[model samples]
Target chain A: MWPGPADPVQDLIDNFADLDSLVRVYPLLLQGFGLTILLSIVTLPIATASGLAVAVAYSTAGTGVRRMLVVAIDILRAFPVLVLLVLIFYGLPFLGLRLNAFAAAVLAIALNNTGYFGEIFRAGIEAVPPGQGEAAAALGLHRMRVLIHVILPQAIRKVTAPLASNALELVKTTSIASLVSLPELLRSARVAQEQTYNPTPLVAASLLFFALLWPFARWVARLERRALATGH
Target chain B: MDRIAENYFNGAVIAAALPAVLRGFGITVLVSLSTIVVGISAGLGLALLRCAAIRPLDIAIAIYVDLFRTLPQLVILVFLYFGMPYLGVTLSPFVTVVLGLGAVLAAFSAEIIWSAILALPPGQWDAARALGLRPVPLLFLVVLPQAVRLATPLITNRAIAITKGTALGTAVSLPETLGSAQSAMAIMANPSPLTLAAALYLLFFIPLVALSRVLERRVARAG
Candidate 1:
């Protein structure tokens, strides 16, 4: 009887005019947002460190090891992040290793991000010239010293923008954890929507996500533009 | 060994679930192809509009591109599928996935195509104008072919990445590859269906990934 599609304008207003519900769901959404941020915060460092290690190993490994590593990274990259999550969460129990939802999500996403970041790091490393390494060796610097002093600094500089972009992507991906029943932003939004039979919570969640991610997205865009301007 | 086989790698479970998974694969391919086609066509149109340099229209297109590009794909999918019914509009799951993914694909494609157009040497435009070609015909006849060629490798790569997003349809219960596998696994109580699903995904995407790689190398060499 009330705004049942007959009055389209009124219908639109009624759908979104629920400030009380919006305010009610705010704390729950914020809590979920906090967890999303924490997930990314925990993931970034682990992914970066492991990615660097994998890149370094790839560079120095023998042919067999290099081949194996390349194949593994390829498979990881090829699988969708969601599929990887499902595989790790569901498949691991069969192997007699069970993980809580949070742990499983972190492990799966971090592993996937490692593949991407390792590739970026390798490209950055390869972008450095062979002449620089040889010149350092000629100067009697030990191999490790040469790497730390001459190589890694430049490689890190080259890869920073890409690494930042990957971090942002990791942030967005943390939402997938909700599918495994983690009460992250998306799941919280779903819960609110079901509870109130209103979509305002979903809209609020989207706005929160945009607020959280838009600045990073713009920053990454600026970094890319600056890199391009510098002819990198 | 038998217990391990029964729980994780049960052959009977895989054989039972293979047909449903295959059907889901068909749906995945169809949805992906439909999205790609719609996305590319819409993207080309947007690129054309942007190239015309109409101020207000360009601003609107820019906003559309940025919004789709910045937001998570799942957010859009959930909003369209789950949130729209509240507003008195209902979209089937298939249409929802297509529209959601198509919009994203359009944003990327528009950027790529627009850049390709910009990268064309200015002299080509001048030359065509000197030959008495109007802007519309010149853009369609002289410029689009070369721009599309330049954009092909990038477009293909983006297509592969976005097409993988078809799996996100599973979130809406679309019964695509991942969804069918999840349901099958739930029914059989064995994880082998998931193993099968993973293999099917690999079988479907690995070739496209490799092809994109080759296309990238070819484009680089051509440049």
Candidate 2:
């Protein structure tokens, strides 16, 4: 009566928000959800630490070494995370280094994230006034001690917003691991959708992602606004 | 080193795969450009509508922006390409990628543009009004240009970042650069096409990255 074949609302409900299929797919989605979180937790620290280390080296290195580091960072940053993932996952076997899908996803994402975090750390470090370093040096602090103890605290504070933003990006980026069959949340949803001949699982997965990420997104937005207000 | 070059940088495999990779590069460029155009325009429209400050409309726009911002583009693409058919609405992979990435980009750009508009001095609006410019004319002639200028660097960065999602089109088999390269790698039993694809991506994106850096510096100087 309402349309050509059936009610549009009912069709949408059955296709998108069907509770029965959602319930059936919940277990698989839960497993994938855990893996997604695990991937983020594992990759974030490795990326951040190595990226910070690079930024430190860049600050201390000679001009030639600094130029080489900048070139490498730019190339890595310019490379698409997904292509890097594909390259690591599919292209690495040729070099006789085979990684499983999960390891490849983590490594690829870490590499990409490091490029970004390195740039952020460099900017943050640069933002600190030179006087601060001189003051630390005049107090007989070693260069590394000044950087680690005095300079880094201020640098990290200045860049917290960007760091959080990049972390959020990393969490979202984990979904791409699905493409290489890592059985993450998105992949699990796809499997369930195929099995049930329904899209409800996909909808559920998106809801899960939103539920996990929305708060973080809002926090990043708030941090950005505050940074803007502070004239950063 | 020599073996690495032979395996990944094979001259013959690259030559064999060049045509398909080029075709895919074309699709990648088409998708990226279409996404940029759609995203920027739609975003501007949404931001303009937002300027009206109607309560329900503002709420709806906020929800749209937040929802799109929260969901990953690949999830949206997968939903549109694979899930929509169950509801009797099907989009081709190309449309799906464009629509998904474009929608996400639109959300981000809308927020950036809206913030830029808000950041404009109130005096600008008052001056436009005093000059006898009607609301639409004031917005178009005075307000929007400033807002667009303020928003340009940010919108450019976000656009580049989101448009990189074009690589995700491989998931739905859109046969863009990465997809074609993957297929070539499979067929030629070498990863040369992937290497070539990486080089192509680097060539395209490095300039944009450098441009973003320049724009960022400009903004910092202006501040």
Give the alpha carbon lDDT tens digit for every residue of A72-133 in model 1: 76677678889888988887787788999889889988998888788778767777888988
Q: What is the C-alpha lDDT of each candidate?
A: 0.84, 0.90
DockQ of each: 0.53, 0.75
- Best candidate according to lDDT: 2
Off by over 4 Å in 1: A1-6, A156-162, A223-232, B1-3, B119-132, B216-223
The TM-scores, one per candidate, come to 0.92, 0.96
Computed on C-alpha atoms, the DockQ of candidate 2 is 0.75
Q: What TM-score did chain B of candidate 2 earn? A: 0.97
- Per-residue accuracy of model 2 over B1-223 as CA lDDT, tens digit each: 9999998999999999999999999999999999999998999989999989899999999999999988988999999999888877899989999999999999989988887787777999999899899998999999899889888887998898887889999999899999999999999999999999998999889998888878867876676
CAPRI tier for the interface of model 2: medium
Chain B TM-score (each prediction, in order):
0.96, 0.97
lDDT, candidate 2, equals 0.90
Per-residue lDDT value at A106 in model 2: 90
lDDT of 2 at B210: 83
Best by DockQ: 2
Pairs that clash in candidate 1: none
